[model samples]
Structures are given as C-alpha cells and as structure tokens.
Target chain A: MANEPDIQSDSLLTVEQAIANLQGADLGLRVYAAWWLGRFRVDAPEAISVLIAALEDEDDRTEVGGYPLRRNAARALGKLSDRRAVSALVQALGCSDFYVREAAAQSLEQLGDRSCIPVLIRLLNDQVPGTLPAPEPPQLAQPFDAILEALGGLGAVDAIPLIVPFLDHFIPRVQYAAARAMYQLTPSPQANHYGDRLVKALANDDLQLRRAVLADLGAIGYLPAAETIAQTLAENSLKLIALKGLLETQLQHTTPPNLSQGAIKVMTLMDELL
Target chain B: MTDSLVSLIRAVEDADSSNRLLEAVENLAAARLEGAIPTLISALSYNNPGAAVAAVDGLIHLGETAVPFLLEQLDAHNYTARAWAIRALAGIGDPRGLVTLLGVATADFALSVRRAAARGLGMMKWHWFPDNLLEIAQAEALEALLFVAQQDEEWVVRYSAVTGLESLGLAIVQAHPDWRSQIQSQFEQIALNDDSWAVRARVWMAQQRLQTESIVQPRLEEQPSPLSETDWQMIIEKLYDRKGQERLVFAEGDPRRYRELVVAIAQNPKPV
Candidate 1:
C-alpha cells in the first residue's frame, strides 16, 4: 500500500548502529549512545520508528537520549509528518530528561500540520515563562529555542497566538526568538507588537544582543524594519552587515533609489550624533 | 585562566543566555577534565551565586584536584564558599573532609548547613573514606548516626548517613541488637514513605548492593571425582582392609557423562 522508495533503512545505519550498540552496553554508555543516535533521526525519516521504540524503554538511562538527541528525533519525526507518530512524540514530552522534552516540542513544530500548535503553545509558556527554576549552572537549553526556530522555518502561522506574548520576556534571548518567529509566521496582526521590540533592540547599546537582533530581522526581511536597518548602516559605530542586508533585499525587489534616499535621512542623524 | 575559560566566564557575566557557557564549564570539571583546576577555582569567587554554584559543581566534578582548594575554603569568610567546599570534598570521597565535617556537625550553623556537612562525611565513607570507616561507624559516629538516623530535617543527609551506616557492616546497630532493631524501626519511616526523591534514589542503590552481595559467593562448593577402579585397583586394595575382591570393577564409557560402575564381589563374603 506504501511506496518502497520511502522505506529505505540503509541511509539510517547511523541510527541502527547507535541503537544496536546502545542497547547492548551499560546504562550510562547506553544513554550517551542513545542520545547520539536520536540526534541522527532528526534528519532521517527512517529513524522515526526506531526512536518510537527508544521512548518506550523503561530504563531511564537506557532510554533517555538527553536533550540534543531526543529533541531532534521529535523534530525529525515531525518533519516526516506522519500523523501516527504525533501522539508518541507528545508522550515523549514527558520523558524523564528535560532536554528530551524540549526536543519533543521542537519536533512538533517541524510537523507544521496545525494539529500540534496548541500543545506547542502550551510548552512555549512552560519552558520560557520562568515557570521552572533553571537547572543549576544553566546547561545549554537549545531545544525550546530550536522548536521556535522550526516553527518559523516551517511557517507555522498558527504559532503567532503563542509567540507574541513571549516577546515581552525580560530575558533578551526569549524575546528575540519570539520576535523572530513572529516575523517568519508573516502577516499575523500581532507582528507589529514583536516587530516594535526588535526595532528597540536594534538601538540598544549592548552590541552582541543588538547584532543578534538585527540578524534575525534581516533574515525575516520585514520591509517595515527597513528604517532600523537604514539607521544602523549610516552609523560608523554600527556594523556594515545589517545595512548591506537591507540594501540587498531592497535592490533585489524594490527600487534602489528609495533605499539610497532612506540612507540619506539616517546619515543626517549620524552627522548630528557625532 | 585559559583564554577559552576566561572568555566563557566573561560570557557567563555578559551572556544574554547563561545556558551553554555554564554547561561547558561544568562538564569539563565533572569529567575531572584535567588542567581545568585553576579556572574552576577562580569561578568559585564569581559574583553571581548561580555562577559560583556552577563553579562549585565543576570543582566537585574535578574531585581530588580540588582538595587543596577545598582545604583553603575550610577557613573562608563566605558561607556559600565553605558550604560548597564541604559538599565537593564529601562528594569526591576524600578522607580529609572528615575533620571539617565532624567539626561542622556540632557547629552552630544553619540546620541545613550542619546537616549538609554530616551527610557529606557519611557520603565520603561510602565513596572514599579510609578502611576505618567501619570502625568509625561502630565507635565515635554513633550519636551523629543516630541524629541522622532519626532527626535530620533533610533526607539526602539522613538517607546518606543511614545507608553509610548500614553499608559499614551495620555495626552501629549490630553491636547491640535490641537497640539496633529500635533504630531500624524508627528509620523504617524513610524506607517505606516513598515521599522524598533523594531518599528513594539512595534506597534503590542500597537495596541493589544488598541483593548483589547476598547472591554471590567466593568459592565453588563441589568435590572431585574418585579414580576409576581399572586405573588403580591394586593401589586401592593395598590401602583397604578385607575388601580386595571388591576393590576392582570396569566400565568402558565416558567417565564424565556415564560414570557409574559396580566393583567386584568380596572374596571374604563369598567364603563366609
């Protein structure tokens, strides 16, 4: 009933090798190996079924792949977009490992089929809204952020309902991610709320967070953000990268003369600040 | 500090997100990632409690290399520094921590802090204390063991002390059985309650060791097979009294698989 071409396991040897070796070793070894194999599944559809089995393993050390692997497997399975795998991934959000739960969230975004939007919106709140005390010494929390990125890349327009409120986060990373995700889900009425904050970030004195914000804006190509980009380009203090990006987009699509004119206004302001 | 470490520590202060920087440093220490000792020591003095806590964990992870640093902190002004050092030394199973732990157990510190020191000393006994651990368990540590045995407010400390006492041959209770039973009955509250995660985890570990020890033994209890009659009949007859005819018998099958054979009838029995 199904096509044979979609069922190949040969490309998934990395996952199989990971599984075979993991299930055979000591508990700690099994966990480390399982995590790596699960990461391989994120890009390989053949790994979805195997990952589902890993989730059912009762031994926490044997089953848990930590955050990197679990999240990717979830996202990867979602990318496969098989409706049957959705609930299994949902159950995985309850895996004992915090990172695995985070990964499950991101994978739901990759599926982008709309049915997962509600659960994901719930998770974004739990993970980002300071509901959980941060783990001691802050380990890299990539999965939740990765999920937000996936939602944007997959153009999950339904996500705007959840993504908008997080832009008000006191933590710059969460606010920056929410703003960027909102921009990617384009045409949402609430994009203005997030977009305005991004414009403010562009003017903030902290250069690193500021640069990260501009990069996201440039990536999203919000023509409304053209003013922010134009402002950065005219200042000798600001990097040429943001301006180059805005000018490139405008030149490629709109008339170049209009951008040059906008650049003139930003230059006049720069002259005053000096 | 190495450039990468200084950069990461700086990043910890300046980071928009403290997540990865903290993890990298901690993992490096936990694996006893060598040559990272100096870096982690500097981080212990960081302004942020979170960063310092993270650094302390890294130091704990470094284990023995942190001993000198831990020893130095035994006299520090910072309560947090002293507290974390006690925890790290205990976690590393270092015997040097015992004196400080013994001192702090009686010191007028916060109950949590005192409980932490007592628990750390107990943890060291299991993981790295000297052979006198069992001796210490039997003699000088009874009151503290009893305190941890019943009254400590924290379960990690309480369970650790109880389990350590149990592992050291149960001498605290064994030296006097009736008193020991009473102690066990009192602490049965923990073994059965199932309320605290720390208690449950330690219980699981303790029970696993108990089960393993009981089921394994050092020697295989089996006897070797006697020599076949055909191989040494005369030699056997010379050693035995009045059973010369019965001393020899023969079978022609594999000895290990089909080894049964009947000896010859006794000549004395036949004559009588």
Candidate 2:
C-alpha cells in the first residue's frame, strides 16, 4: 500500500542524521540524537558503538550537576539491545549524577545482564552521607526503585531476601517497585500477593506513581491485575497497554493460538477501554 | 508605610545577590502589607526566579485586594512578569481575572502561561457573578477551555485545559442539570481520542468525578438545607488547596504524613 523508496529513504536518512548528530559538537543535538536512536530502537552496529561512546561524554554537563549525554546514551544502549554495551553501562553505575545512575540501572535491566547483579546488589545498601541534616526524610542514596526493578528483571533469585525489606519502604513508588520485583523473582501463587500491592497503588492520588505501577504491571504481565488495571483511575491508553501485556503473556503460555480465558478477559477489558 | 517596610521594598530592587533578593521579597511578602503590592508586582518582572516566586506567593496571599493592581499593572512587554502575574491571578481565583485568564489560556505564546491560565479558568470564583450573568461567564470559560484542550500544541497545556474543563463542568452541571450529558459525552470523546496518555488519564479521572457527582446530586437536593452549587465549588477549591499544601510539604518533609493525608482524602467522598 505504501511506496518502498519513500519509507526506506525517510528512515535511513533520519538514522544517518541521528548518528551524525550524536557525534556532533552541539551538546543539545547529541542529547536529542541519543534519545531519538533509543526511541526508534535503532539496532545498527554503528549506532550502538556511537551510543556506547556517548556514555563517557563529559561535554554535556548541567550547572546543577547532571550528565544529560551519559544519561541519554545509557538509556539508548539498553533499548539498542547490544551486549557490547553491557560493560560500559555497568561502569556508568558509578557516575556522580544520581539520574545518570538511575538511567544506567534501568538500561542494565533492559539489557538483562546477570553479571551486573553484584554491583546492583551493592547499590541496594549504598547510602550517600548527607552534607546537611537532609531537609526531607532520609531516602536511599542509590535509586532503589530502578535497582530493585533491574534486579528482578535480571532474575536474581538470591537477591529475594534483600528485596523483601523494601516492600515496606517509605516511598510508595519504591514499595511498588519492590512488589514488582518480588513477583518477577518468584512467579508462583504468592505472586498474587505482590500483584495486590500494585493494585492498591492504583488508588494513590499521585498520577505519576499510578503510571509507574501500570508499567510495572504490564512488564510482569500479571494477569490477576488485568481487571483492576482496567478499572483504575489511569489513562485508558495506559490501561490498554497494560492489558496488551497481560494478553501477550497469556498467549505465550497457551499451546494453541486460541485465546485463553485470561487472554479473553484482557481483550474484553481492552475493548471497553477503546 | 514603616521605614523597615520601605527598606525591604528598596532592598528588593537593589539587592545584588539572588539570596539577598529572595530574602527581601520573602520578607516583604510575609509582611502582607497593602503598600507592598506594587513592589511585589514589579518583582514579577525581575530576572531572579526565587524573587519572582516569592512575589507571586505574596500577591496570592493578598487575595482579591491585589487584583485591581495586578490587572492594571500587567506588563505587556515582559513575558516573565506576565507569566508570574497569570500564576498570581490563577492562585487568587478572583472572578475579575476571568477575562485575562480566558485571553491567555487561548493565545499566550508561553506554554507555562497558557497552562496556568487554563487551570486557573476552572478555579474562578463563579459565585462572584450575579445570577443573571453567571451562566454567560461560565459559557465563555467553557469555550476557551475546550479550544485549548483540543488545539494546544503542548500536552501540558492541553492537560491543564482538561483540568479546567472538569472543574467548570462540575459547576455547569450543578447549575443547569440538562448540560450533564453533554459535558460527560465531551469528556468521553477526549478520553477516547487524546494523543497524550497523561491527558487521557486526567479525562478518565474527570469522567469518574462526573459520574459520582451525578449520583450524589439528588441526595444533595433532598437535604433540608440543600447545598448550593457555590458551596460545592468552595469545597472543591478547599480540597485542591489542601492537595497543593500536601504536595509542598511532601517534597520537604516525611512523606508518611502526606501518604496518610492522601489516604484520608481518598476515603472521604468528594461531592462534585
């Protein structure tokens, strides 16, 4: 139905330009290019290598102590799905910027590298000493939510005891993250308990927290949450995305392509949302 | 004005360091003196964000008393001042600022200005209008909010517009019961079609609020001393104000208290 030349030219031209910009002198362009490559899931070797190199970028620092380039590069590398990026991203875990470390941890989870487990585990106990009394209550120095999610996604069964304590973490988002990881590490009947914690989070007044819970539910494909997710006070599109994840998981487990009851329920909910 | 108040006003204009300027503005704002209104409005035009923020807070604290000066002194050339002024007016929620909010919500070049205006439009003190003119004023606000919701390029502005529409919709449905279906249908269409997930999510929340309001309306009407639409508006405003306070405290203190408050708020029935 569409012209082949136009499609090829459009995508290729954009990819090449993004690659060029990632290596360019402009800091903003480089940051944008890194995000573009990751957003489009560009998996070309050149793109991956350039993005890897970007992880070490020192040029794009913010005045308030942030490394925008490194953050974007680390995020892009994860989406690129290149094993070569695993080492660089692991090293980025030590970056001074809190957000860069957060982004690196999330990317490592996506890359699914088991070797990064020890480093991530150490991060669970990492606490940065505050200069002042900490105007707010003391939070984990390390990004616990990202680290917990990463550990869970990487299938670190030995880290289960470590993850359990965070189920009662002070922050609701962190608590939800712990619940998400707990379910992922142990997907038995007890997974429903973790699923219930996530369900309760849907009632949180914070929209951002609710959005994160939706993503976590979708990521783990917890079918028990499908109906509750549908009725939650979140965006219908997010509800649909979460339901799609549940349906996909159901289809994967079914021997035949025919919809299982769980899949049918997810589809029906998705239909109502649409 | 006292000499210290005059000094604080002068200090706001002459302070070299950002910290000093912020302190001066905060002191003046905390004073809550009528004479300091002009200086607070002028501070909105300053390059220091901390000073501007303090000034906006001060103006909001002055309430409707500051509205006339804010309306007359709104800077045409300074976008920063205009944006902060819009925030002040939005926070005040005086009915007199409705026209300005409507103007900027639809046409402001700055997305932040437009976003503030859009949200502010819904929060207007509709009770200030006489019974004869209230519907007309509300209709104008609804028209502007609908335009912004459907046409704004920024997702954040459109998100604010949806928020405006929801608040205004609650007010409208109570005043004219026949309009409930139309408002609900409009929200449904937006929920089904909006490009931003956040916007759609907000619309989804708005739909739930509308449905709850519809169910509660008859019970409210049956009361010995029936709650008027203005009473419902005041309650909504108080809840929103409480939520805003919770957010501010949540950022700087133990979140356990904030979480407890959120739970309490959620458990309580919010009459639309």
Candidate 3:
C-alpha cells in the first residue's frame, strides 16, 4: 500500500502551535504567531478569535506609544480572509498609533467589507486637534493614504468628492493614494484622467512614492501606463509586480481571444521584464 | 606616524569592542594625518559596521590623497570592504577614481555601491584633468551616465545618474560649448520618458537650473572665420549623426532654414 502523508494533520499542528503562541505570554512570540497565522492564511476559528483579541492587546506597546502586537494582529486578520475580524479591524481604526490604524485599514480592505466604508470616509475628514504635522512632507494625523486606498479598493464611489481635495495634499504619497482612489472610484473613460495624476506622480524624486504609484497603477489595471511602468526607474522586481497586477486586472475584465491593445502591450512589457 | 597615531591605529586593529573600534576610527579620522589613510582603509575590512562607517568618513576626510590607496586596496573578495571603498572614492570626487566609479556604477552587485558611484561620476573635479584630456574624459562620463540613467535596474541609481548628468552637463557646457545641444536634448528625453517620477522630477529640476544659470555663452566671436558651406555641411552631418535621419528630415528642403532652426533650438531648448 502506498503511504501518503496527512496534509490536514500537518496543517492542524501548525494552526494549533500558532494559536498557542498567539495566546502565549511572550510578546515577541505572540507577534510572530499573529504574522504567521495571517501570512499562511490560517482560517481556523481559534486563529480568528485570538487575532481579534490581539487587536485589543494593551501589553505590547512601543516606547513611542505604538501597538506592535495590535498592528501585526490587525495585519494578519486581513490576510486570513475572514469577515469575522472586520469589526475588530474597524475598531482598530481608532487606535492612537498611526501605523496600527494604517494596518487596520489595509486589512479591512483585504476583507472586502463595505460596512467599513463610512468609517474610512469619516477619517478622510477627520481633524485631530493638537496633533503635530509629520516630520517629512508634513501630513495630517490620520493614516490618510491607507484610508483612501482602502476606500478605493472597496469601490466606494460616493467618497469621490471628499477624496478630490486630497489630490492637492501636501504629502506626495498621500496625494498618490488620493489619485489611486480616484482612479478606482471613477468609471472608465473618466478614470484614465485620475490615472494620469498617478502617472505624473511617477516623476516625483521619492522612490517610495514612485513604488506606491506603480502599485496603484497596477491595482487599478491602468493599461495606458504599462509602457511607462515598464520603463520606470524602479527595481525590476517592483516593476514586474506592478505589471503583473495590470495583467491580472486585464484578464479579469476582458473576454477570451479579445485582449485589448493595452493588454497586449502589458503582456509584451511583462515578457521583456521577465 | 606619531606615538598617538600609532596607538589609535592599534586601538582600531586590536580593540575587541565595537564601541572602542568606532572611537579609535573616529579619532584617527579626525587626526587628518596622511599616514592614517592605510589604517582607515584597513578598518573598512573589519566586521563592525560602525567602524567601517567611521573608516569611510576618515578616508573621505583624507580627500584626494586617499584616492590612489583606495583604488589599490579595493577588495575583490570582500563586498563590505569594497562597498566602503566605493563610498570613500565617491566622497572624495577624485578624477583618479573615475574608471572605478564607472565600472561599479554599471556593474556593482550592491545597489548602494552603484548608487554612490553613479552620483560620484557627475561630481568629479574636472579642473584636475588637463585641458587636452578634459573633453575626452567628460564625454566618457556623459556616456556612462546616460547608460545608467536609461538602463540601471534600480530607480535610485537611475536617479543618481540624473544628478550626475546634470552636474557633468553643467561642467561640459562651461568647458565645451559645442556639447550643450546634445546635453540639452538628452535631458529633454529623460524628463519626458523616464519611468520613475523621481528621476523625471530630478530631470525637470536640472532643466530649470540649466536654464536659469548663465554659466557660459557660446564664443561665436572667438572663431577666426565665418562658417563656409563645407563647415555648415559638416554641422548638418554631425546633427544627423546625433539625432538620426528622421529628426533632421523636416528641414531638408532649406539648409539655411534648417541651420536657423538648429540654432534656435540649441539657443533656447524647450522646457521639459
């Protein structure tokens, strides 16, 4: 008789070990477990419940008043593809730590929950009093980039008017997020105009901003930008990833045997990069 | 070497603690002794990142004097030491390191090394080269920079290439007036099509600077005689060589008009 290993048994062991570490006293191990569960896409109910509980973790605070555990947990929850963690992620949007809030917004986007749209939009207009401007590029207190990106991914078209002003945001990265969200919310024909703003942002001297804009272009499947993305001065790896995003987007939106000229161009570019 | 320099060198080589090595390197670097160059360069091969950084700073402080030693001591087997050596060579901006800088900027496995080398290429001390050799050197530098700008896989390196191009362009325009049109055209193309917005933005800033800065004007009066038909034909041929046939084909019907158009464009290239 041929012996086949039990894949289910191995996964169960991993899930149980991750759950134990998540509930363990060691803060570092808990953080690792949270990341492991989400990274590996563990969808166990125990994993979800513990990750949700971790969002409220009070013990794992950074010297600068940031919540490392809460941040990692929130990030993992989104990757698990579980809707059960959505409410906890939404609540995490109110965390004092900007990164925690950013992480929460990103995960919430991954969960594809529409209920978080109102909360995210409110953050667009959120005016935190007494908060000092960011050291570089001088942005507002809220994680506007993440919020806007999440809103766009959720297809919240109603948030368009509110997001428009952020195109003029002082921080270029935030402006890029606004442009990306605008492109996502606007329908085709009108959408390329917003995509152009991102294309223009690709000229910014900040590598991070260029990378972000490339990602935004890819996520929106902005095929008009394929040539530009391919030629962009970013690392080939990042350029390839962005092009793949565009290709995936094209595949999903087009029918078989009728790839648009833009799609064909994107594939050609990807071929060259590969 | 003085007694104090010897002791500092000993401290750098024999110190077990990272902090001690860093302090020794710092003191040695601050000493600015010519003899300390070898010791500082040796410190680069040490495992401690902090000491290596201090050693690089010290070598930079040594400036032109350290260039020859830096070039000779570049470790082919040790990437960390080689990277630090590149940084030192880049920081000094010595003409002697130009070949090394060009080689690494184009082919270094480490992105940071390539980045430093790319930036260094633009800032070489042109005055150090003899007038006869300056033109040739600048041309080589420009070609390397153009290749890096268009071809480097990393945006930051490409970005550095733009900076190098601008600085070198400024130097070339001052020294070799005939090269301005080519430099201007190169910048225009980079600004229009470079994928990284940062690289594009840098090109824009460079164009603005080139326009606003009145570094040098063409010395038309210095020519002993006016351009004859043969000279004009040669100029047209050179233009064709640089821009290809398609770009120059527009003014084929009228050579005078073509010459005028070329002059106008070269005198006032369109802003990116």
Candidate 4:
C-alpha cells in the first residue's frame, strides 16, 4: 500500500484521462485540460487531433470556457514548431470568429516559414483590423499583441519582399514590424550596400528619390558622403534632408572643431541656398 | 382645468435634435422621474423622427417606474408610443427590461430607433430573444434607405466619423442638401478630399456630382505622399525618433539581430 504509486499511475491511463477531462461537461475543466496538454505538447497524436477538433468547438457561444480551444491549438503548434500545423493554422484565418483568426495568424507567424510571408503579407490588406468577436460578458481585459512578436520572431528571409512594402504604412506600428522583419531577413551587406545605393540615388532623376536619398545618407552616418551631401545641399530642393542629415551626422561623430569641414560646408551651402 | 390636453400635444410636436432628446431618455431609464418621460413621449407626436426617438429611449429607461404611466400614452389616440413601448422593451437587453425595450423596437413608427430595437431583438442570445423573429428577414432600415445615418447634416454627423454603413447615406446627403439640409455646405470637400472612396462616392451619387479626378489621382495635399524608395528610410528614422539605449529593443529587432546594425555602427562610430 505504501509503494502503490505505480499502481495509481497505471490505474489512470493519463492520455485518456486528459482527453476525458478535455471533454468534461464543465467548459472550464475541458479548456484547462486542453491548455495543459497543448502547452506541454505531451498529448498523444490522437490527443493532438482531439485538441485540433476542439478548435472548432462552440466555446465561442459557451460562457464558461477558459479559452476558445483554438488558442490552445495555436500555442501547442508554436511550442512544437510543428511544420505540419502550418496549413491548418493558415486556414484558420477565415474563421468568422475574430480571436480565433488572430490566433491562427499568430501561430503561422511563430512557425516562421518562408512560405508564410505571402500569407502574412496577404493579411496586411485586412484593413478592418480586428477579427476577434466580442466575447460574451466579462470581455477580455487585455487585448492580445502576440502576433506582432510572433511575426517578428519568425525571422524568415523570404519575408523581406512581403514585409518591405508594408514599411510605408500610414500607421507606424505596421511599419515598425516590417522594420523588425527586415533585420532578421537581411542584416549586414544589405544595410551597407543598401546605404551605398541610397547615397548614389541622391543623383537619381526622380526628385523625390533624390530628396529621400539625402535623408538616407544622413541616416547612414558615413563621413565620406558628408562632403558630397554638403555640395548637394547648396541650391538643392532636397536641402532640408541634407541639412538635417549633415547636422545629425555631425552630432553622431562628435567631431572636434578642426574636423568641422562637413558641418561648415553644409552651413555655407545653406546660407547660399536660403 | 388648465390648457386642454390637445394644446400640450401641440407644443411638444415641434421640438428638435431627437438624438440628444433620446440620450436624455437613457438618463431617465433608472430614475423615478416623470416630467421628462411625458415630454419625451409627447415628442413622439412630432413629425421630427428625432423627437419620436427621444420618447422611446425615455420610456425604456423609465422601466417599471414609468411603465404604468406610459401604458396610458400607448392606449390613447392610436398613439405611436404604444407601438414603440413594446419595441423599447427589447432594446433594454435585460429580460426584465424586455417589456419596455421590445415596446420601442417593434413600435410601428417610421423612426430609426424603432428599427434598431427590432434588430436588437433578433441579436439577443438569451432565452429572451424569440426564435420566431429570427426568421423575419431584417427589414431594411429607413435610415439606410434615406441615408439619414449618412447625412452630414449639421456638424452632428460627418463622412469621416461614421464607422458603419450608415455613413454612406451621410456622405450622400451631405453633398446633396436638398435631401437633408441638416448637413453642412462642406459636403463638397468630403467628396473632393475625404479619404474614403465609399463616402466620396455616396456623396457624389447623392448630389449627382463628379470631379474630373479619378481614384488613381490623389487630390493634392499640403504634404506630398512618400514616393521615393528612400522615403522608407525616412520612415525608419522616424521609428527611432530617439537614439541610444532607448531604441535598443528597436535596434535589436530581427533586422539588427546577431548582426546588430545599431551596435556595429555604435562600435565603429562613423566620423561624419
């Protein structure tokens, strides 16, 4: 009797117990079992399939369910980094329920597959942002910001093309995510080469490009480009970016007065232009 | 003994801004007050839809406190409030509140709130919402048909502010004042400069107005849209508006991960 722990463990077929608990008439108990199994990823493949089936359960209409089982599914998939789950997660995007859709979007992001970029990009066009339905009473207090982090973490190189376009979003948050994805996809030479092209682009035919390039050069903080930038600041329509860049670059360097040639040249140009 | 009841009817018939008067009704829902209830119910007689809404909203808030008193208003002179009383019972949302909200939602007036009450009736998920009405295809709202919800009339409504479909009507009526003068003259600006195409189109169709500019051409703004590829670079700079450790998380985002761009730059600080 004292050493009967093994018998106790044997008496309870744990996976069956978890699945049975997951099916309790009590919604909260069922959700808890699903959540624990999903998070621990210890569920039998049959149990994983059970949790997945529960994703479509009407927890939405139930007042007592701890979470819609779909979140548990997504979290489980993310924990497992199970590549097989990607298609199912992507399919969840169309769930009439908004929160479920958000979870699906987030799970796909967590998977961080190069294939998911097109899907993530496709979501950017979802101008009507929230898909999460209004939960029945005791509305969720803290809204989820999980998808942003998940997308940022995916760090898939293929996301570069898809994510780059959204960087110009009217809302800064969207652009911030795109910027984050950028560093993950293309870090070193892209930055250096991209910076070089930008400096060269200051001479582009398009005035807007030229103006933008001046600002880009400023952001690069490259000392060699400062003299050329100073020359362009003189009587260039792109003067403001040049002037700002020159000032910012000077500050970045903390140059001694003797090395003030770049700042001095830009100032003389500004006086002439003004 | 005082002025005949008919004259009391005449004065309340001319009141305005039904939406606010309706708001006034909400405050009275739990209050034991009686004066505002009758005034609001009396406004129901007015041709003004706003005044009628005030009456319904007022009665729903009055709950049991004003119910018996209001029963007389519905029973008299084929009064509109009687019909509205049943519908308002539905909007109150609570089952106990049902007798009142339903009184308003189904009330047979041509007013907008009455329709909202009916739809509200169908949406109630509890034992309260009847399954029978669920099959009743939602009657198209007069608010939608007349585009009253979209009316830019007065500063009270505008094209940009509306979140739902009703704004389409507001935009239409805004540009076309003959439809509803409640909107301002700047309806033209809404058509010409507003961000939403649906709003602009509604206003244009309502006024039967057109601008030569196609959707492809953005109307001129005080500032230009970002056009150059490097404009994206400007956007990135703005993201890190402040420098140093404050932007460390921003700098470390995937773009700057193991090959931390900000760190690399800081270590080899350029002598610009």
Q: Each candidate's chain B TM-score?
A: 0.53, 0.75, 0.74, 0.28
Best by lDDT: 2
**True lDDT of residue A32, candidate 4:** 62
Worst 10 residues of 4 chain B by lDDT: B133-142
Cα RMSDs, all models: 28.9, 16.5, 18.6, 30.7
Q: Encode model 4's per-residue lDDT on A199-262: one tens digit a residue.
A: 5545554444455556445544444565566544222324534554555455445432222555
DockQ of each: 0.01, 0.02, 0.01, 0.01
> What local lDDT does model 2 show for residue B249?
43
lDDT of 4 by residue, B1-272 (tens): 23433333334443255444444433443343555566655555543433444555566665544544554565666344444544444433333332233334333333333434433433332322122211111112222222322443311112212222222223233233443333233445565665433344334433432222112232244232212323223322332342222345534333423333533332432332
Q: In model 4, which runs have C-alpha deviations exceeding 4 angstroms?
A: A1-15, A62-67, A112-115, A127-162, A165-175, A189-274, B1-272
Say which docking band candidate 4 falls in: incorrect
Error of 1 at B234 (Å): 98
lDDT for each residue of candidate 2 in B1-272, tens digit (9 for 90 to 100):
89988998898889887678878999999999989999999888776655777888899889878987888766566767878788889888887677778778988766777877888988887654544345546766877888898888776678778778877877777677655665677777777787765466557667766767754333333223133445434433443454464364433653323544543443342553
TM-score of 2: 0.49
- Provide the TM-score of the second chain in candidate 3: 0.74
lDDT of model 1, residue B29 = 55
Candidate 3: segments with Cα more than 4 A from true spot? A1-13, A127-139, A256-258, B1-272
**What lDDT tens digits, residue by residue, belong to model 1 across residues A1-274?**
0111222343444655666655564655455555555444443444456666555665553222344444444545655556667788777765656656666666665565556555565665555342232244454433456557656766777777777676675567677887778766767576666677777788665556776777767655455676665554222223233433443444444341233443333322322211
Tens digits of per-residue lDDT, candidate 2, A134-206, equal 1235634778899999999999999999999999998888999999999988859988899888988887766
What's the number of clashes in each of the models?
A: 2, 1, 7, 42
